[model samples]
Target: MSAVTDNLGLFFGGYLRSLSICLWALVGSLVLGVLVAACRVSPVPPLRAFGAFWVTTFRNTPLSVVLFFCAFGLPELGINRSFFFFGVLGLVLYTSAFVCEAVRSGINSVSAGQAEAARSIGLNFSQGLRYVVLPQALRTVVPPLGSVIIAMFKNSAVVGAFGVGGDLWSTGQTLTSARGLETLPVFVGIAFFYLMITLPAGAILQIVERKVAIAR
Candidate 1:
């Protein structure tokens, strides 16, 4: 307790850095995921196949393996700076697979009539997905998307294991070692810090989900 109280600045700084990593990772994953989901549902056969392959490949891989490749393996191939960016990339690459699946499921949930109606009005596949289907699909996907985000928040801890600095997991390790092993207060404080982000986020998404809920 005394250790944590004395080192408030360190904890806060680490948490802030971790939050930044998660934020950027989340944004990138969502964007990539949507594009992948679009590919999975593409009217063109090749695109759909490629998208399915992408999801299967990443989803089958471990996050640690992906991080290792980004942080270490890529440099051998002259892909530099991905070491520092690995934490961000790790979350994005792994999470996007799940995100794509969630969005695709949402797309499936939409009634076939909607697409047919759009087609009747001359709205082709791409156009309908862009202007009509994705919007409705997003509403259905929010709850699952929220869950994915929360999982990403937790997974951000793995970044620290890869030596990315100023992350909460690394900070916790440093703090515990610097102090004695009896750092209950430190863990309690950390849990509080995590809940600070997750609880509010969950509640906000729940509200957004309610608002966006389809009438069906």
Candidate 2:
């Protein structure tokens, strides 16, 4: 308890930063994912190819490798920056691929007739996707999308290994080292802290999904 209480402000503050990183990363991932998913399902060959390329490249690559590249590569390109920015960037670029696939799966679930009927009504691919396909696709995908967001939130811990100071993981280490405390309590606290974030997010998604389903 002392290990956490000794620096109460530090723990809570770092937790906030971690949440902020996750929030920013989630937004970035969803935007990029939707675009990539669009390309994957697009009628144009090149568009589909580009989307496939994106999914393959990111999905296959390890997050640590991408993080190292961003953390190191940015400086080589003369964009000296903090680990927080790089961490968020790495999370977004890597997780967006999974988001793309989940969304693509949802798009796939929509009946072929939906799209065909849409086309018969003079709706083009992009317009039909926006007005018709996306609405239904989103309903099916909410749960999986929520899971992805939670996974990405947990992934923020990886950045702590790289010495990003204002995150929960690093803060845990900071408290442990500075207070000369045992590691177990610190880690357990960290785990509970993460659960606090993920559980509520999952609940919110479920509530929103249920509401949407009821409305539809």
Candidate 3:
């Protein structure tokens, strides 16, 4: 009991650091996702092609591979990291590709008539999308987006394989190595930490979905 209590602070500090990275990754992914969705839906062939390529490439590639490329390969190309920025960057870009598909599906769920009605009211395409279309689409996508964020948060642990410090899994490894403790407690602690992040996010998404349904 004393051992567990003794290491609790260390465990929590690492969990919080990882959570912060996850939150930043979530925001970055959402913004990039919105842009990619726009590109996918655009009438221009080049834009559509670019979006398709991005989504396919990133979605199909493994997350760890992407992290390795960005964290290690990028440094060779002159990109340096002050902290664990590259790990977060990799999570953002890789996860954003998946988010883009989710957002695009939500956009498709909005009927063409909605856009047409906005256009008939004298709104331009961009204006209609910004005001009428995207709001609805975003509302519809909140649940899925939340799921993506939770998954991204969990997966952030994988960065530990690349020597990224101060994350939950990395902390577990450090603790286990130092104390020669059994793996079960360390992993259980990690799972609890992840649940702390995912559950609230899931509840918030459910609330947003209900609100959107009411608005509709």
Candidate 4:
């Protein structure tokens, strides 16, 4: 507590950085996830195959490996960028696979009659998905998407370990290792900051789920 109190600015700074990582990853993953999910459910065989490949490759890989590749591997190909960019990229790439699956399952939960009806109305595949199917699918997937986001937020901590400075975990390390603070208090502070994000997130998700439940 004293460690956190003494370094309030550092702790809060770390919290903001971590929050930024999660927020950016959330948007990126959601957009990418929906696209991948669309590909998974598309009538075209190649699109489905590509979607399956994407889900299989990314879902099977560890987050650490993904981040390592973005952090180190990408640089080797002469695509150097800030650690923050790479960190968010890794998070989005990894999380989007799970998000895709969640969304795909939601799409599948939709009645076959729905698509047939869309065709009955002369709507093309993409048009049906855009106007009719996807809207319903997104509503159904809200709860699972919330869980995916929470997992992504936790994973953002690992990004800090890979030299993305000013995140909570990195701040903890700096405090205990560099500033001679006790590890317990430093990490306790970090945990508190994490909960600050997660608890409200969980509550908000619960509300969203309830709002969508009957409609879904």
Highest TM-score: give the candidate number: 4
* TM-score, one value per model: 0.92, 0.94, 0.93, 0.97
Off by over 4 Å in 4: none
Predicted candidate 4 versus true structure: per-residue lDDT over 43-118, tens digit per residue: 8999999999999999999999999999999999999999999999999999999999999999999999999999
Residue by residue across 1-216, what tens digits does model 3's lDDT show? 344566889889887988888888889999999899999998789999999999999999999889989888999999888447888889989999989999999889999999999999999877888898899898778778877887897888886667778888788888789778777777788778778887887887788789888997
Q: How close is candidate 4 to the true structure, as a TM-score?
A: 0.97
Ranking by TM-score: 4, 2, 3, 1
Error of 1 at 208 (Å): 0.8
* Regions more than 4 Å wrong, model 2: none
Better of 3 and 4 by lDDT: 4
Q: Quickly count the clashes in candidate 1.
A: 0
**Residue pairs with clashing backbones, model 2:** none
Off by over 4 Å in 1: 178-183, 214-216
Q: Tens-digit lDDT track for model 2 on 1-216? A: 676667678878888988888899999999999999999999999999999999999999999998998999888999888888888898899999999999999999999999998999999999999999988998888888988988998898897777677778888877778766789878877877778788898889989889977976
Clash tally, candidates in order: 0, 0, 0, 0
- Candidate 1 per-residue C-alpha lDDT over 140-178 given as tens digits, one digit per residue, 9 for 90 to 100: 899899999999988887877898887777778788886
lDDT of 2: 0.89
Residue 129 Cα positional deviation in candidate 3, in Å, after optimal superposition: 1.4
What are the lDDT scores of the predictions, listed in order?
A: 0.86, 0.89, 0.85, 0.93
User: Top lDDT: which candidate number?
Assistant: 4
